[model samples]
Target: MILLVVQTLNGFQLGMLLFLVAAGLTLVFGVMNFVNLAHGVQYMLGAYLGVTFAQMAGGFWAGLVLASLSAGLFGLALEWLIFRHLYGRSDLDQVLATFGVILTLNEGVRLIWGSAPLELAMPRLLSGSFALMEGLRYPVYRVAIAGLGLAVALLLAAGVHRTRAGMLIRAGASNRDMVSALGVDINRLFRLVFGIGAMLAGFAGVLAAPLISVEPGMGENVLILAFVVIVIGGIGSIRGAFAAAIIVGLVDTVGRGAITGLAHLMLTGPAAAKVGPALASMLIYLVMAAVLALRPAGLFPARA
Candidate 1:
């Protein structure tokens, strides 16, 4: 019971992280009608930036803010240098170009930071555990990560649903030609959306850095997960991203624990242990496939 509870929390925390990354990816996809295979690298860069800022400023909060800004600026720079040109290009071209960017960023990080995974220490203020119940305790930093992620989700929801800027974003995504016809500078909107997306991805990276090994190519797996999340949540829908991210996180985390336990019931220790993780990895994809089969537009698509 205790193990289940803890794993559930862990999974939820992971889901929040996934939300951060997926939010940006989905927005960019919906609004720009552009495929950015290099999006994962933005997350990677955020982790690296967090590491640099944390050490330089000698604090976690400083690091978080600086890392996010750096990541946003870096993304903006990419938008100007490469993505801007690819806006009207073919999907194949965008994919190829972004993929090239990914390759470049990956190698650049290796050259700059080396291939070893960087370690980030949790902020001193949050480096302890707190009681979740009478006897159950959870890491404070993990709780903080979830809290921060949720706060971001709420802010995003508010902005998208209530703000003029978000309205424009939605309008641009749903009907770019119409928005453009109305005198909206579609390019500027694209830039803002891309920058925000980059910042969100980076924010996720910064938060996860202390929890996971800070390394190159780390974004690749999470990027795939983010894609699954957006697909399940519905592209261009922040609400859907939030819901799907949490669902994916809980499902992935709990499935691993449940599968391992179940395998032990049917097989010997070694075989159960070996097969448990494999099945767990496939669980989310299975769910995604089922969701797609039933609703090709996702559970909450932003557009028809």
Candidate 2:
């Protein structure tokens, strides 16, 4: 029971980070109709920046601010230099161009950071575990991370549903042509949307830096996972993203542990050990496949 509780909490933590990253992805895709394979690079940039700034500032707090700012600026610059130009192009063009950006950025990072994994130490204030129940103790940092994610979700929900900019964003998503015909400065909206997406991805990267190895290609796998999240949640639906992220997180974390144990029981130890983890890894993808098979439009596709 204690083990289950702990794994559940860990899954939520991972899901929260996924939400942070997927929120941007879904929004960008829903509104712009553009596919950005380079979105993962923002996460990478954030982690790298966090490492660099942390070393300079001697702490995580200041480093977070500096890294987030840098990532946002970089995102905006990329928008100006490349993404904006590709908006009217085919999805294939966007994909290829963004893939190029990914290659350039990855190589650039390797050159700058020397292809070595970097890590940030958790802040002193968040570096321990707390009693969750009579027999369970949970890591303080993980809970804090979960709290931060919930706070961001609330803020994002409020921004999307209650603000004027959000209304414009929704309008753009529902019908870009109609919004543009209404004389909305759709270009400005696109830039803001893209910048926000980049910032969120960067923020997620920085948050994750203390928890995982910061290295080249770290974001690539995560990027694929985030796409799975958005797809399952319903592309362009923040609510869907939140719900699906939690689901994916739990299924992924728990499936790995529980499925392996079950396999060990049902098969020879050696075979189980080899195949169990492999199944666990595929578990989420299987879920994604099931979700798509059932609902091609996703669970909460942009309210349309």
Which residue pairs collide, candidate 2?
none
Cα-based TM-score, every candidate: 0.95, 0.95
Computed on alpha carbons, the lDDT of every model, listed in order, comes to: 0.91, 0.91
After best superposition, candidate 2 residue 160: deviation in angstroms? Answer: 0.3
Model 1 TM-score (2 dp): 0.95
lDDT of 1 by residue, 157-239 (tens): 99998999899998877888999999999999999999999999998999999989988799898999999999998888788
Error of 1 at 221 (Å): 1.5
Cα shift from native, residue 138, model 1 (Å): 2.1
Tell me how far the alpha carbon of residue 124 in candidate 1 is from the true structure, in angstroms, after superposition. 0.9
Residue 258, candidate 2: Cα error in Å is 1.4
Model 1, stretches more than 4 Å misplaced? 131-137, 266-275
